[model samples]
Target: MYEDGEYGRGLVPYLSDAMMNIGTKVTYQTVIYPSASDDWILAELYKLKTMQTRVFVVHALPDLASRLFKKVNEVGMMDEGYVWFITEGLTSQLHNLDHKEDLMQGVIGVKSFIRNSGKLFDFKKRWKREFRSLYPDDDETQLDTSGIRLYDTVFGLAMALEKTQKEKGDSAMDSEGTRALKGGSMLLQSIRNFRFDGLSGDFNICHGQLQSSAYEIVNIIGTGEKTIGFWSPKNGILKMLDNETKGIKPVMWPGDSPVIPKGWEIPVSNKNMLRVGVRIGGFDQFIDADIDPETHQVTMTGFCVDVFKAVVDALPYALKFEFVRFVSSDDKRPAGTFDDLVFNLSIGGYDAVVGDITILAYRSDRVAFTLPYTEAGVSLVVPIKDERKSAWIFLKPLEKELWITTGAFFIYTGLVVWVIEHRVNKEFRGAPHKQVGMLLYNSFSTLVYSHSKCLCTLLHIILSHMLFVWFIIC
Candidate 1:
């Protein structure tokens, strides 16, 4: 029997009815804490164990199985439980996680989508094993069942487990105890011979795939080297494994080549090498691979097959391209150009400016970029706290202590002139003594000067008057 929807709000009465009908004595508790934090989840689980409840029908979201497993470890319990019902995602989703080897080891069940239909006892046994291994203090009497999203987790696990067991014994029974339940050995063996299709595709519990085949193996690479795992693209799918009895020639790819049928040839006369443009600083990724015009032997350079594959995947399969060359210093740097104004960027030349191109000194030829591609105007570098909030980090080192000290001296010089003339700014103004000391700063700030006659005159008048007044007052 089963109940649905949000636990207490929708199915409490139904669950009670099912328990009563099943004649099973059950104990329950309403222990509440911050049901949110992972810490709370673990602490509560341990506390629940101490409470003598055999089964916990948790009412949380289905995705909390991983959390529950991790928290259970935090609570100092290992591999103890009779049964667990988790509220989680579809069984297929769980299987996918497992396939990726990303399955959280401790989680044993799901409740969200009850995907399997089979006998209950067998599933209960396996689930009991899984739970005990995860939370060992758990036993049959404890029936320590708990899930984050309790309902979905339990439903999904129960369904998948039941369906799986039924499938094991699902085949038609044979006489002479061949398919009988006597340890189910013969029956399991028969089932092993049974290649039944489940939600995860076709699988045989008995005769393993490639079990009967023997083949010659060779060491293509003499020493230890990178190995590529060959996976059947159609492994475990129904549409696959149902092919008519036939033979297809084994495909081989040559050494250092990604092209399939490793030694195949293409009938061609002259080979043509082509060049294409990628974004700046991506030339290393677009090597035109070498191929024999006769044999189609695709030989790539040191360690770039995946990169090649990615580029190949991006383009259409019908079209073929090969990588052949790597960039050299000559390609990267410019030797001669159109004029001093125009800098050459490898394949082309353009007008140049100071600091217009990024070159590794001798290694690269400077290229002129367009006014828009590069900043057109002189950079008005505002203070970091002001307009430079989004300035590039590369420019930060350029504004280091040396430049700041030089600029500071210039600033101090200007400030001293301003102060001596009583035209000093409020921000820099101090008493006469401080002004005198800062006037010592004047020598360093050679460029902190007035470029206009009006400013110069004002500065001179203030300085002249202050000198006269200071001498007279002293």
Candidate 2:
């Protein structure tokens, strides 16, 4: 993988872990760009072109990623046998990218999936009209996943507020005249429990987060992204949602090649021996380097050294390499620190580094570290204390908003029935106060099947059936 910035740094470890779990070994190389407009892009592209790995996972902001891809295309790295996969951060904003058709052609990307529905279609039409009116000059008004999620959020809040209003009337002020929603806690609870079939698929909130259902895998083709497949927790990768197939659809890869790239190959450059850097003074058990005076040949041994040799030997093809000791300027001792050794590898001083090198976040920014062979752990112990529970803890099972919503719906249903039956049924027709009393008594009494009133109007029966159907569907 070739990436840059903090996003790339954070993503590399997870990608490494996932690949390792699948019995695949991955190597990562960082592309350091001092700034967005740096002239080093072309040079960096050339350097990457000389490397053996053709498959690259890119994780950078849209601007930097776009520039990098442009340089990649200029250097002919987008040709056959090359593979590029971009993360959701860049892929989600594909519409904002300049010359994306040329820069991102045949690039594979994964983005949050938004299912198609009439609701989404209508919302898009209205959104496009309003967005165009506000920004007439801007052509990129198409809604993305972020926009869809934002819309869903606002819609959900509105629904929660509407329910709150029905349950507790308008917002009220305290004795100190501070305005607040009459049932603020209930409002928050309603928001957390809100669920809907929204533009962004099933909008369900759990543990204060909007749950993601699946990811849509897309391939950049011409002026748009082509949905090649989908990935979900339940199903791995499926070419069709209804199909149980385990792999993605055939991809139109870079250089328009239908054949899959092998991901890596031996560098074509004349340099044959891989320059492996070894720290000179690490613990002898992890690594040790020695030179024979008679033959003047360097021999490397120890745990790390043996493992490295075994890995290279197990490769499908022969890998010629020689261990190069990283020594001080005086040529008598090891380099300054492991940081110095990794920094040198970043600058092309070594093709790879092997020894008792600890993986640190700072060092990872400059170079990638392979999976550690050593077991690592850290534990912290803290004193535990007992505390008395709050008196309101009894309300914890169901949220306060759920209780309020239930009461509100009971009253609402009763009011609907009364409106339909008051004109025809004697039980519903009475003095204003008496009818109001009956409304409350019957509403609550229905929960215990203690209501004495009977539905005498056909409208009431039909409305009851409609409510039953609604409850069933919900």
Model 2 CA lDDT for position 295: 95
For model 1 the TM-score comes to 0.20
Model 2 residue 436 CA deviation (Å) reads 99
Best by lDDT: 2
- What's the distance in Å from true for residue 270, model 2? 7.1
**lDDT of each model, Cα atoms only?**
0.39, 0.80
lDDT score of residue 194 within candidate 1? 51
Q: What lDDT is reached at residue 120 by model 2?
A: 89
lDDT (Cα, tens digit) per residue for candidate 2, span 254-356 = 9999999877667777477889999978688989877898997888989999999889867744477888889988877987788889999999999999988
**Model 2 ranges with Cα > 4 A deviation:** 1-20, 23-26, 29-34, 164-185, 269-474
Top TM-score model: 2
Which stretches of candidate 1 lie above 4 Å from their native place? 1-8, 30-35, 76-78, 87-474
